[model samples]
Target: MNTENDNDEKSMTTGKAQRGPLRGMNPIVTLGSAALTLAAMALAITLPEVSLAWLTSLREALSPILATYYVALVGFFLVFVVWLGMGRYKNVRLGPDDEPPEFATFPWIAMLFAAGTGVGLLFWSIAEPITHFGGNPFSEEAGTPSAAIKSLSLSFFHWGLNGWAIFSVVGLSLAYFSFRRGLPLTIRSALYPLMGDRINGPIGHAVDIFAVVATVFGIATTLGLGASQMNTGLDWLFGIGVTSTTQLVIIAVVTVIATGSVVTGVNRGVRRLSEFNLGLSMVLLLVFLVAGPTVVLCAMLVQATGDYLDSLLAMSFWTGVSTDYQWQFDWTVFYWGWWISWAPFVGMFIARVSKGRTIREFVFGVLLVPSLITFVWIALLGGTALYMELTGTGTILEAVREDVAVALYQTIGTLPMPSEAIALTGGVATLLIAVYFITSADSGTLVITTIMAHGDPEPPRLQRVLWGLGVGALTAVLLVAGGVQVLQDAVITAGLPFSAVMLAMVVGMVRALRDERFAPVPGQKHRLAKEIWTGRDEVS
Candidate 1:
């Protein structure tokens, strides 16, 4: 009977393999995703101003809904992920109980930090705090001590638990369903509990397609931001003109490097780059801490963390319903939307590297560790800048307001270092940003190809290169068309529907966990009970 059941399962698997769409690819997903990507690119190129105008209009039209949904959804994710990590299901393993983790702790955490946030932290760590200090919708005064504190707290809030929660839930669902249930490692697998065998049907195809589109646009947005910042760094350091043409050239060069990394595979290429990123980030953080107001920065870190913790609930649910719409729309809503958009890509990459870990371990590692690192980074970088502004020693706020991309360089200039040291620091920073750009593009390439290859971890090298170049190209197009803001708006638009899919994923994961079929076998307790019962029966 057992043999027959095994044979039946094999037969079903073989049948699906034989009938799968487009030989190796899911036809619906491949075709649909390609069509949408191409259409978006064409729109951006042919009608640049019109396309941007429409995106702006859409944002304006959906401002209220976007604000409310993002606030509620991210807040719910934060609670749900924490509950999963700490509740009864904490012991559940993403794979078989006997399987050990694939990577060691340091590498795992390093990869998560590098791939999850990439260069965004480097770009915004100073700018965001300074911008918020200048004037935030939540605050009544500008450039005051209270505003400065609020700035750090709000910056931490944006980059902290809420963002990681988005990544955690998605990664948890994908890893659990794929590794434990022996399903394909794709976005559609998260729906298996609800769809069952129909996960191989049109519904499954749609889910994967949505993930592909979101991943592409999300990655493109990051690439666009990185290019702009890189351009700014070049301008500040070497007097290079920050033009669209120069930025496009930078994108092309980096894309080639990323393609090379993708060809080397994850273990050699992605892992090494991630480790390098971690090391360089540490050096930058250390320098900032040592050179700046170290004592004040430490105090600010403690106070800001406390403030963030105390106000987490209020800030999480604050939709700005009756307050300043533009402020909320620009900052909070935009951040939530951006994080959600990047969830599929970052979440999928994390799941791929996170096999053989327990649910609780994965959740905490993804949520807590990186988030704390982010807070410290913001404190060291942003806190130092805020202190400078308050003391009237630096004018970073003016630079940030004028061109946010150059905020990091401007802040570094204000440090009490010599001109030569400042120049060297700027050079190192540029190098770090470039490598981070390559890391993001390559990892994104791997994830996109895996989806396109129906969740094959080692997809074709050609496909990887294609997707890498495609991401770079899309970034260039958006940069020329409407610059970084357009890219931002585009990602938010893509993220709205994907957010709903993520909610469904949460429901499916919970439902699947409730089913006893997936639970661990009863071991020591059952054996002890049996031994006692047998002794009593024999005595009787």
Candidate 2:
């Protein structure tokens, strides 16, 4: 092994991992992702009008399988993560036996929150519940007690464990393989058990190429959406024009800030930004809880929590096969696709910051803590909207229907605080959205650097900036072309390949975990992956 390491070092020094004069860069992934991005940009620019027609036709053909696949993927991940956290492998550490976590609990959890949801929580916290309250298959009649109850409960369902489970599954597999075993921290490493050294060849490059493209398009879509929301917030607060020029400015500003964050590296730039995002989220959440219908929100929180927990099992598998398949495809299936599309970026970010945590610790912490905070955040913000609608003090549902972007501003507008304080709250909400936007972009930048550098968590600063700018440029071009939805559809297309990749990772993870190093605890028999022909314990 030492001899092999020496040879490998010599090879890297002789430029196996180098691209001519460039050091620590993988040209295949870098150029491949860039080429893919340019192709997508060309489509979005030259043919934005009919961009969705082909994708719509394609998804229509694949809708049944795609929806079923995403649903099952989420369901399988939920069970996999819960079992890891609670069952025999609970004690397995992500690193050496005595290794301590790199970040403290608070910062770790804070960064986890930043990586997972970011701006979407603020954007949807007000919009989604109100949409459901207006009615779903569960309640076609709007503005009723049942609708309100179902609203918050459904929000919990979408934002809760199902989404996080996908992240956890990917993060856990990568962390276990990278840290516990001696592998590079890249998606290809997840297949080492099945592929052996073949992961170092074309197969590995192909997998990573797919991951890079998916991640690039995924984050670009978010930048476009987040910028639009920020544009709306600015117009609502400061009367700025909601022109494309305004949105371009917003995108440029976010790109510069995110680039700055990535340059400082994770310990300072990313970690500080994440902590700030968490703190600001709490400040906004607490203000809403205090200044709004405080008691009613609390009561709603309890009832919503109860409802979410009570109906989790049923709802987890409740695809709209029988009733309103379009509705489920639009909402639940859309979200599942969104999460899957983001798994590479978010999951890789989580794994990078999550060294030294036990499997149990990582699983539960990722699943429960952020999820509980989300519940409270949604209940506070969305619940306040429900209360106003119930009492007829505000037209939140109307605003949501007309324009979901104003939903947050509208919720703040109706707060019982004085007129001046309402303006102050609006400013804070806007700032929160901007910070969430920055956290997400910077986080994606950092994660992309690793993939581009072939899994170096501390990748080159130049490459980091390049990746960050790449995302910004893609968003700007799409925004200017009026083709963000086109880019988004392209992301959904990219995600189909990755969906298969995720399933492969799962099978490899199961096979890899059965190695002798992860033998059963004392007196507890290992769940046998019995030998069928060879001596190795393989799942037959």
Predict model 1's lDDT versus the native. 0.85
lDDT, each prediction: 0.85, 0.81
**Model 1 Cα lDDT, one tens digit per residue, 19-122:** 33345555567678889999999999999999999999999998988888899999999999999988777777777677789999998998999999977888
As a whole number from 0 to 100, the lDDT of residue 300 in candidate 1 is 93
Q: Estimate the TM-score for candidate 1.
A: 0.93
Runs in model 2 lying further than 4 Å from the true structure: 1-16, 19-22, 481-484, 516-540
**What clash pairs does model 1 have?**
none
Off by over 4 Å in 1: 1-23, 516-540
The estimated TM-scores of all candidates read 0.93, 0.93
Number of the top-ranking candidate, with lDDT as the measure: 1
For residue 76, give model 2's deviation from the true position in Å: 1.0
Backbone clashes in model 2, listed as residue pairs: none
